[model samples]
Target chain A: MSSQSVVFIGAGNVATHLAKGFYQAGVDILQIINRHFDKAKNLADQVDAQPADDLNSLMKDADVYVVAVQDDAVQNIVKDLSLPRGTLVHTSGTVPLSQLSNAAPESGVFYPLQTFRADQELDLTQAPICLEASSSETYQQLKALASTISNQIHPVDSEQRKTIHIAAVFLNNFTNHMLACAEELLSKHNMDFDLLRPLLEETWQKVRHHKPSDVQTGPAMRNDRQVITEHLDRLKNEPELQAVYRVLTESIQRKYS
Target chain B: MSSQSVVFIGAGNVATHLAKGFYQAGVDILQIINRHFDKAKNLADQVDAQPADDLNSLMKDADVYVVAVQDDAVQNIVKDLSLPRGTLVHTSGTVPLSQLSNAAPESGVFYPLQTFRADQELDLTQAPICLEASSSETYQQLKALASTISNQIHPVDSEQRKTIHIAAVFLNNFTNHMLACAEELLSKHNMDFDLLRPLLEETWQKVRHHKPSDVQTGPAMRNDRQVITEHLDRLKNEPELQAVYRVLTESIQRKYS
Candidate 1:
């Protein structure tokens, strides 16, 4: 019997990270398909796998097909890719795994519960691979594949996967956005941005165990009108940042002593 | 002729941190005075110093007197101290060492360029000490004393110190407010706040060594209209945060490729 092969149905950032992880872990990446032929070929080249421009033409005996595409494209790709019985999966955060039809013999989820970027060096070991399967045997196969790359694996259905995804958005995406805002503000003033690194690192470390509200310190929280007014004056047309300050100060004061 | 004893004119966070730092560095803190003597005495006890409610008594026979009071109180406290040949220093970001007047033997600044909390573990060795003085001898003394506690010391004059302080505000205090806002928005949505930690940490890391513009990432920079709109909608009531997002997005887009 041939070793089980996994197929990637998209070549986005998620696809790149997941495929690279799978390839490095010695799993067979049977085929890669993308709307853009060149992009698919490029990603496949990195993993020593062949590319398929047409989903239907990808030799379809793979044990798993990871539909790691956009949220809008998941269903369309699944409908188009006439996969082997129960051998379809989608890696999405917000999308429910059950959206894939039951007619597909082995549909499931292999959503990595972490942010993925093409250039970023993500330690897959820290990723909690959330897996859900239509059948127990498929579930075990997904688990086995996930275990090769990640130390953390969670047996989660669509509902639980979404809750985890929501939590991740709060933890990763929005937080990064906040940092980006800080960077922009700091640069405007010709300051050593590094001055903030220790503080940001400290802030994150504190949050690992303590509540966010407890660690908040600044003029607004202390009701230091002078500092607050100075900051507000600096904000100028950036009323949104001021509103954020007001709302956050109010919220923090309410919840904390 | 007797040991160079100093007096502290405020018992606030900075005063307490500085008093503790001075005591650890083997400097003599002869007396501590405050509007609230209990607070002054509490700090004095920590540093093995005496407490004085009377301004004349605190400054009498002192080799140096430090006014670590509020922004507006520094000048008044220095004027009241009337030290005869004793050094007078003010620990403030905005206020100048010259603000203490030439009536004293020497007037200087010993501003530690880091935020201090009453209970937080402050590694003074890592903190920056911005020292300024009315005379060269006084500068050397303050620098030597600061060097005992911190490796990082700068002989920044009043104007330079003020500019650095402004920069500090942009990087530390303002950035912290942005973080607090991130926490508030995420918490209001019933999201786990831990998600923001890693992203914020990474941003700080990148900005430390590289230009913020070079490392900028997010929906705004990418011109991902869809995601930006979604996030903006999510922050509907948070006009301040929304303004922050808009202003920052514009700045990032303008600054980066």
Candidate 2:
């Protein structure tokens, strides 16, 4: 709607969401390029944009170039990109904004700090979009572009963004593994995994408003050795789970102690 | 309303919620008893029931006696209680139902599977109320009392209930600690913890429907050594967080590998 045409360099989950978000915001999606032509075409078709597998014939007149590839692939893709005049951005939490300096005169970061699933539809309007740029002008441009989809825009540097990324690993990856462990334990006992849902729901409800440490309850937090020991004995058959249980118990105990 | 009178044996978080829930379901709460008379009276005031600090005048005519005490205290409380009639049930996940056998002729387990906070208002209507009893008559009584508040009732033995309790530690306690870790990391960097809420929201949304292992995304899941190493290096100053990060990362890597 603002006459700022954009091209996405990857058609992954992040790119798919961003492209659809932009398209719905009335921005002209110039192209969608991926290493796999099918993937590019698949996403581009939804956004009503051209699809290209090769980087050689990239759109030269776009207002912005979004490099949404994997963190490892971003450097090579940006290095090889030959944009005549457009601000380049990478939607990554870890990668620095400077990585796109060679791709365009203007570079920035537009990281939406949420886990994306290829099959699941995510409304990005409320997700925190952490931004960093090489210049003030580029920052403003990136901010304006991000405003189209999300209002939770934050200006974070590379170091701070890396910290957030690491924190996210703890919040998302590790917490999810904990749930997986619960599922495995329940399934082994022939108990319904669905039985754990209300507890899970209540836990997150508390998490939304209270500090995890303040609301923390369990044998570990209470330092109940009897319960802790009994739980350890129950998990003795699964050494891997026992190790995880022991470490987490020790960590919680140490934190509170 | 069904002429089944109830008496609560503790005024802790579990007792507070259960007592209130039963009162709302039109069940008669004859007395609320706790070691602390003030705590007992505080909850009794809400349900229009009598409060007592001692077990000397426990209502013998009440159809159900609910022991909502700590794991270690259950045996002693049940041992000391002089009940003339009615089913005696303990709301504990770890304590075996047999512990109540000496307290009453009709003994049963009426454990509500949830982490209760005294301040929070919880709807027990959907939470799993696990039941185990010495006789079919006791089971039916507990089930009817449980059904007055919750539709989710399960008949689980001590061993299975213990397994669920252990699993709950992983799901709620450890998972909450992970969020605490994230809060600490973010706070040290002067970042608002609220920024992490959307990610937390989306993570739980995915968790509600999918197997956690399937929806997992992070360096550990992918075994991205570079990112993992970078993150570990960042946590060099915080040894506790570093240990947790390393253990969780290794666990995820081992799980996938």
Candidate 3:
């Protein structure tokens, strides 16, 4: 495959991470476009790419236009953008691919299945790529492109991608919040949060090898009314946490029963 | 400097994890007692201790009797048991140290800061030890025992421990629950849950060196109403998750604001 020029249209965390990942993978970023001129400059400078805030200027020679923006803005960005026909894709979990259906050089999704934080570095090799295209030929090109950066590639459609994102929230966001809650409670009691780190890490590790429902522990899963009541009483003021407690406890019990 | 014989009351997660940690640190486990004889025997076998179903049998010749029972039963167990004064402790975060005051043996708390599942191997070296004792000498003994297992020890009274427990909820249970919620939402759309693992891991990793409020990420932290709304609407039927979304979004906002 010949080296194709890639264009990044966002300068946010995901954009920056993906830009860097692509740069490392030998994809010559033709240009980086952002609403904010300085943001586009910063990202372009980091990746040694041409910085162009106006989409029209970069669209002249862009082989691929990657719309790496917020979920709500994907359709509008794709619709209003003046990119070449059949040459646009949006990196969104929930947004449909049809938004880029308008003539683009070759539209496709190169969704990186990993979280991005500006301060953290990413290994694109391990990051799964959820690739999709409007047609079979484009799909092959996108798959080839994704394979350049990552070995873990999935040719998933929008619906499947959305489902994966939903699961991610439960496993990542909700789990992290629960960890935060546990930390909050333990810290208030003058107990060290680090104390629970072992058990917490083990909780996830067990689920990695064993089925989650099989390895469920803690008061809720055990149906220990005594501990649950005590913890709930402590969380009485935090209505959100109490509701969480009830739902999770019920879920755990239901899974076991 | 001399090793004293020890009697462990209860064979639950806490007791099992603690006893194994203590035994590794060279404590002599003389007896183990639980409501269920088989459970006690199982735990005792692992720790190389004799298992007994009755109080008198387990208590005989025991230098220290650690009560590791449920919170509600703490008082009852203390009152009904006739252990000789000057060596009793309960491993509870909520129960006051005074609950063991009426008991013959002096009382204190040797709380291990971690969640425990029966199958998970607990690494106490990093586990925080929250300790309080009836006397200075007792405190020294408990401190020595804890030091054998972990270096991170906090001399917390029951009141302080309560605050610590509250903090624990934030760091542990609540954070984990939040992760679960996000996973739930992503799964609804057929998204792979693995996408969030790196993000979740990074969240915890960041806090090891940084403040939670400083390192906050996500739609809530960014104040991205669009993403939040889409996420919430996606979780429309999940009242608990929706409530969590509302509460956590507000909390993160206030925290950063």
Error of 3 at A207 (Å): 4.6
- Provide the TM-score, chain A, model 3: 0.91
TM-score of each candidate? 0.76, 0.95, 0.86
Pull out the clashing pairs in model 2: none
Interface RMSD of each: 5.0, 1.0, 3.9
Can you write out model 2's per-residue Cα lDDT over A137-199, one digit (the tens) per residue? 888888888889998999999999999999999999999999988988898889877899999
Better of 1 and 3 by lDDT: 3
Candidate 1 vs candidate 2: the lDDT winner is: 2
Per-candidate clash tally? 14, 0, 108
Candidate 1 structure quality by residue, lDDT tens digits, A1-257: 23458888899988998999989989898788888999999999999888988866877677888889876677777665555553788888656667776536777888876656687777777666778988888888888888888887878766555544434443443345455555555556554555455544445455556655566665555666665566566566556544544444454444444
Ranking of candidates on TM-score, top first: 2, 3, 1
Give the range of the ten consecutive residues with the poorest summed lDDT in model 1 chain A: A165-174
- TM-score of the B chain in each candidate versus the native B chain: 0.89, 0.95, 0.91
lDDT (Cα, tens digit) per residue for candidate 3, span B113-200: 6777777676778677889999989999888878877878878877677666655544554444445555556555665456655544
Ranking of predictions according to DockQ: 2, 3, 1
lDDT of 3 by residue, A1-257 (tens): 77767888899988998888778878888789998999999999999898877766765676677889988778767666555443677788777787777747667877776777787776767777788898888887777667777878888977677666655555544455556655555555555556666545555555555434344555665677876787678678766556656666665555456
Q: Which ten residues in a row are the worst by lDDT in model 2 chain A? A: A75-84
Docking quality (DockQ) of candidate 1: 0.23
Model 3 lDDT on a 0 to 1 scale: 0.71
